[model samples]
Target chain A: MSHRLRILSRIRKALDAPAMPSETARAEAVAERIAHPPQHWPLRSIQTADPEGAAQLTLIGRFKAQLARLGADVIEVGSVAEIPAALANYVAANVADDAAGLARIRMGSDAFLAALPWSSTSGLEIAAGMAEAADVIGVSRAIAGVAETGTLLLVSGAENPVTLGYLPETHIVVLETGAIVASYEEAMQSMLAATGGRMPRTVNLITGASRTGDIGGKIVMGAHGPRRVAVVLWSA
Target chain B: MTARTQFDADIDTALADAPLQRALADVPAGFVAGRRRAREELLEFEPLRRVARDIRDHALAHLDLYLEAFESNATKAGSRVHWAASGDDACRIVLDICRAAGARTITKSKSMVSEEIELRERLQDAEFDVVETDLGEYLVQIRNEKPSHIIAPAIHMRAEDVADVFRRQHGHLAPDRKLDTPEEMIAEARGILRDKFLSADVGITGANFLVAESGSAIIVTNEGNADLTMSLPKVHVILTSIDKVVPTFSDAWPLLRLLARSATGQAFTAYTTIVTGPRRPDDPDGPEQCHIILLDNGRTELLASEMRPVLRCIRCGACMNHCPVYCSIGGHAYNSVYPGPIGAALSPALAGAEQAAHLAEASTFCGRCEQVCPVEIPLVSVMRQWRSLALEQPRSRRARVMLHTWARLAQHPRIYRWCAGIAARSLKWLAGSGARIRRLPFLHAWTDYRDLAAPQGGTFQQQWAQREHKRAQRDRADVSAARARKSDSVP
Candidate 1:
């Protein structure tokens, strides 16, 4: 027998000792659980019963608060058009001046980011591709924001490559205000709905900039990833 | 020396190591205290823990079905799924994949399963330049030492020790560079590892959870190295066990919620990546090929055994953080890939009772591990089961004899009380005025470290009997007085 068969048979034998349901019954039970997952666990911080707009607002508020606590910067812009200026201001303030004196922003070919008016902002060099080693700042668009944990859900594809999130010292995530959700469960459901039940190649639920406490138990941010994660939350 | 004696010597050596002692002191203040704060902040932590346990149990109960589901879904998603019955088999499979990819350089994130299989040494022996990307794991790699702690691999080393190691290994750099703080060390390691990430041909990691629903492999990390590992290389391989599979994304959320909180007191880790398959055809960047190696490594047998709850461990390290034995001796002394309460129960189950019985006997049954476990695994009970299995061995003749004598005496209450009273009286007499015994005959192990407090002149049974008699007398007097008061009221 093959290793897979042998292993499965071993598991069956082990589980056979107990008086369990039939094999068909077990398969049915698994299928049932997967088809209809349980409701979201009640999180005290976010009220699930609020109106849609209010709930989104609550999620955005909670999301910002959680991110702030983790040392992330959240910048809210009035509209998509203001993002370039916001990004430019953030870069000027946080990122150290390089020898070029121009901020280089590397990003994937995401439609949402590409549609933005970036040429209006001066001293900003924009490149549409995967991040490189010398890239100082990388920007990507998040599909959804999780409120309870302040997480960003980024799917990997040609539109938003996974490398852009980890390679740069400064990571700028573009999250629309309407895309913020109350919990991971809702975000997952939305993702499934968007993909027609087929999962994307990669789904990254990023909470903050990369950090490590392995050295003397002291937390040092930007360990092998972005040191700073700046979320530009824009509303229409 | 016998295994028992050698373990004792290890304990003594660990206790005497001053640097280790200093490092161990941080466990309570770091992981333990952090978990407490995280748990306190979440109002639904207790209920969520129960949900997490149930999810794990349900998956394990029908593991065969879930494994099949995961295999089918993953294969459909363009990922090649491989099965290995043991660690050696898993290592060979990984090497074959690397060889097929013509991988000259391999970068790995922190994967305890990979460590369990000793995969790095195997790969390096085949001349693959393997690099550990996690900061803690990188430090341990440079020192040529096994990780002393699961979450914090270099927990045994001080900042200065790390600096010395870096200085010695990175000799091409200036010798007198100031690497004093963790910040400096982190920056230096990051710069060095960034090049490895960009240059590696294959990246390897371990999955915390495998979603049977979508055929996704999820890895949780505070550092972004695992992301870079899976993203940069042309080939990505995930080394994980069969027990990591969950039914759906919903099932994964609860476990994810408990993991970071229990491990480091964070609401969420910095990165939780779920990879369904290889990169899409149009993707700008990601591993072109993805492989999932499902390793059994004696886990199926473990599932059949009475110690099945040991499989519920999520590798949070909370059990170890709260374990008294672990806090004292540290992870190295356990001499197992996993260490502490979970290790005590799991090592015996995986390696067999006779070979690793000393690990089971190393616990004080303080119950802190179970108390802090996110899955609520009965760790103490599992360790006790291992102890029972150990007693049947021929080498446990002395222990069996002592237990047999105690059991016989325990069956008869009068004889047990009489012998216990005499023993307590003698101990009290030996203790003199201080009521502390500085030395004990045939039990120097207990007295060698600290003075054992003498029993207060009698056994527990004698003291309980006396208290019961006095309580009965007091109760009768109170009833009679209540009756007298009622008669006076009637007159």
Candidate 2:
């Protein structure tokens, strides 16, 4: 017998309580388990009213605060048209007066990046691809954002290259306001709904800038990923 | 990767290492404070832990079924699933995959299973250039040392130690570069590893959880190196055990909720990546070949035995973080890939009782590990079980003889009290006014570290009996005085 068969048989014999199920039976049981989700999750709604009443503003405020708390900066804009100006403002304020004068960035030219008017930002070196080691900043789009933990969920694809998320000293992400969810469950539900139950090749849920405490138990940012994560939030 | 059956000697060495002790001292303040703060923010923290525990239990109860479902779906999602019955088999399988891919250089994230199978050494023996991408793992790798803790591999070392290692290993770097802080050191490592990531033929990461429902393997890390490792390489391999499989995402979130809070006290890790399969046909940025290697290295026996509560471990390192023995001696003392309470309980089962029984005896039975465990595993009880099993084997004749004598003395109350009373009186005589025993036969190990307080008076039973007699006399006097007062009132 193969190693797989041998190991499985040994485990079954050791268990010795019931006969091993067939593949069909196993699939059914799995379906049953998935259909009946486990309980005791703290993510349920406590108040029984419009979840979007005053809580929408509360969630937006919480999301920005939590994101800032986790070493991320948020720039809330009124619409997608204002995103380019917000991006320019963030760059001019934070990265314009660098040791090299202006900031250099590798922006993933996804649908989101393509939508932004390029002529707006002057004196910025922005290329379209995965980030290289020499790149000081990376820009990408977040598929979704979680308000509970201030996390941005990005899907890996031809447009939103996965490397653009982590391969920079500073990472700036474009997030649409409508995609923000109050809890991980709601975020997951919306994501599944959008994808039609197809999980992306890679789903990166980034909560904050990269950090490490391995040396002398000190919290230091910019370990391997971006040292700074700034979100350009688009208001619906 | 050498397995030391002499756990006592290793622990002795660790206890003597002043640097290790000092490094361990910082653990309580760092880990405990973070967890407390993270938990305080969440109203559902305790409820999440219960759900996580139940999810693990339910999954393990039907482990065989879940494994099959995971394999089927993962295969459909364009990933090969390999099974290994033992550590040797696991290594051979990984080597075969590397050879098939013509991998000359491979980068790896933090994987305890890779440590368990000694994969780096095996690959090196095959002349593969293996690089550890995680900062902690890379530091340990450069120093030619094993990980001290599972998560925080270089927690035992100071920043000076890292600087020295970098200077020694990366001889090509500018000699005068000031590497005083972790940031400078991290920057240096990142610059060096960036080239390796671009060049590595394969990347291997450990799985935190495997979702059977989605055919995805989840990896949780603060550093984005795992992402870069998998995203940059041509082939990505997940080296994990069978127990990581959960029924679905519904089951996984609870464990994820408790894991980060229990670990470093983050609401969520900076990055929690869930990789479903190999890169999609249209996907721009993932490995073309993604493989999952499931190793059953003595875990099948654990699943079958009464000691199965241990399989519920999420590898959060909370148990070891709060373990007094671990904090005192550090992870190197355990002499296994796993260290702390979980290690003490599971190693004897994994490595064998004869070779690993000393680890089970290393605990103080304080149950701090159990108290903080996300799954609420009975860690003290498991350690006790291992100790009992060791006791039955009678490995050391002197230990067995002493235990047998104590058992005999403990079984008889009259003889025990009589002997205890004499011993107490003699100890009191020895102690005098100081109230401490400076020396005692067969207990130098205890007295060596700290003084044993002398018995101030007679045996506990004798003292209780005397107190009871005084109470009876006082009660009778009170009753008689009450009767006298009543007769006077009547006259």
Candidate 3:
């Protein structure tokens, strides 16, 4: 028998010895659970205690607060048109003035971000492609934002390469106000709906800038990924 | 002098190592305190733990079905799934994949499964350049040591020790570079590893959870090294076990909720990436090939045995963090891929009860591990089971005789109380003035480190019976006095 068959048979025999439900019954139970996965209790912090719009506002507020606590900068802009200026301002404030030259912001070919008025902003060069080793900053559009943990859900595709989030020294994500949700389950639901129940090649739920406590038990930021994560939350 | 066991020597060495002692001292304030704060902030932490435990239990109860589902869905999603009956088989499979990819350099993130199989050394023997990417793991790799703690691999090292390792290994760099702080050291390592990430041909990681519904492998990391490890390489290989497979993403949510909080005291790690398969045809960048290797080295036997609940472990390292024995001797003393309470319960199952008997004996059975475990595994009971299993094996005549005497005495309460009372009186006589016995006959191994407290002059049953008799006499006297007072009032 193949290793697969041998392993499965061993598992079957083990369950059988324990007098557990029959294999057929177990399989049906598994199938039923998968078809209708039970919903767990939502976090009390994100429970809806007001109207929809107010609840959304509360979510965005909670999301910003949580991210701030994790050392990520959250910039609120009036609309998409103001994002370039916000990005430019963030670059000016966070990027160190180095002798090597102008700060270049690498991004993917996401239409939502590419269609933005980036030409209006000066003093920064914009490159649209996969991230490179020399890229100091990379911008991507989050598919959704989870308020429960202040996480950004980014799916990998042509529109948003996965490297853009990890390669750059600084990561600036653009999240629309409407894309913020209350919890991971809701964020996953939105993702499944967007992909017609198919998962993307990669889904990143990033909560904060890269950190590590491996050295002397001290948490030092910017270990292997972005040192700083700046989110431009724009009202669409 | 009585001959000391290897386990005793290992503990003595660990306790005497000043640097290790200092490092272990920080764990309570670090991981332990951090978990406390995280738990305080979440009002529903207990409920989430219950749900998480149920999810793991349910998944394990029907693991065969989920494994089949995961295999089918992953195959459909362009991922090749391999089943390995043992660690050697898994390593052979990985070697074949590397050979097929024509890989020279391989970059790895922190995977306890890889450590269990000792993958890096095997790859190095095959003449492949393997680099560990996680900061803590990198430190361990460079020092030619195993990870002391699961999450914090370099938890045993100090900053000065790390700098010393860097200086010796990184000879090409300036000999007198200032590497005083963790910041400077981290920056230096990051600069060196970035090249490895970009140039690696294969990336191997461990899965924190495997979603059978979507056929995705979820890996959580604070440094995002695992992300870059899987994303930058052409071939991404996930080395995980069959127990990691869960039913759905929803099933994973509660586990995720409990993981970071239990492990590092964070609401979430910096990055939690769910990789379904290889890169899509239209994707700009990702691994072109993805392979998931499911390992079952003695786990099938464990599942069949009475210790099936051990499979529900999520490798969060919470049990170890709260374990007193683990805190003292550390992971290296256990001399296994896993250590602490969970390791004590599990190493016996994996390595067998005979060879790993010392691990089960290392615990104090404080029940702290079970209290802190997110999955609520009965770790102490499991350890007790291993102890019994170990006893059932062949043993010395002295040990067998001692155990037989203990069993016989424990069955007869009268004789047991009489023997205990005599022993207690003897100990008290030995103590004389001081309340502690500085030296003990035939038990010098225990008393060598610390003095033992002398027992009181009576057995526990004798003392309790005397106290109860006095209370009964006082109650009767009070009742008679109350009756006399009532008669006088009636007249």
TM-score of each: 0.95, 0.92, 0.94
Categorize the docking of model 2. Answer: medium
Model 3 pairs whose backbones collide: none
Q: Point out where model 3 deviates above 4 Å.
A: A42-57, A97-101, B1-4, B396-401, B426-444, B447-457, B466-491
Residue A189 miss distance in model 3 (angstroms): 1.5
Ranking by lDDT: 1, 3, 2
Stronger candidate by lDDT (2 vs 3): 3
Best by TM-score: 1
Mind giving the per-residue lDDT tens digits that candidate 1 earns over B405-424? 99999899989888988899
User: lDDT tens digits, residues A14-41, model 1?
Assistant: 9996578998999899989878976545
Q: For residues B1-491, could you state the per-residue lDDT of candidate 2 as single tens digits?
A: 22333676776788788888889889889988888777777767776677778888878877877888899888988889999998899999889999999999999999988998999999999999999988899989999999999889999998899999999999998899999988788889878888899899999999999999778999989988899889988999999998899988877877888899899988889999999898888776789999999999989898888788899999999999888788888988787889999888787877887777667788889888888899988888888888887766645667668888899999999899889988888878877788787777776776665677988557899889999999999999999999999999995
Error of 2 at B205 (Å): 0.4
DockQ of all candidates, in order? 0.61, 0.51, 0.61
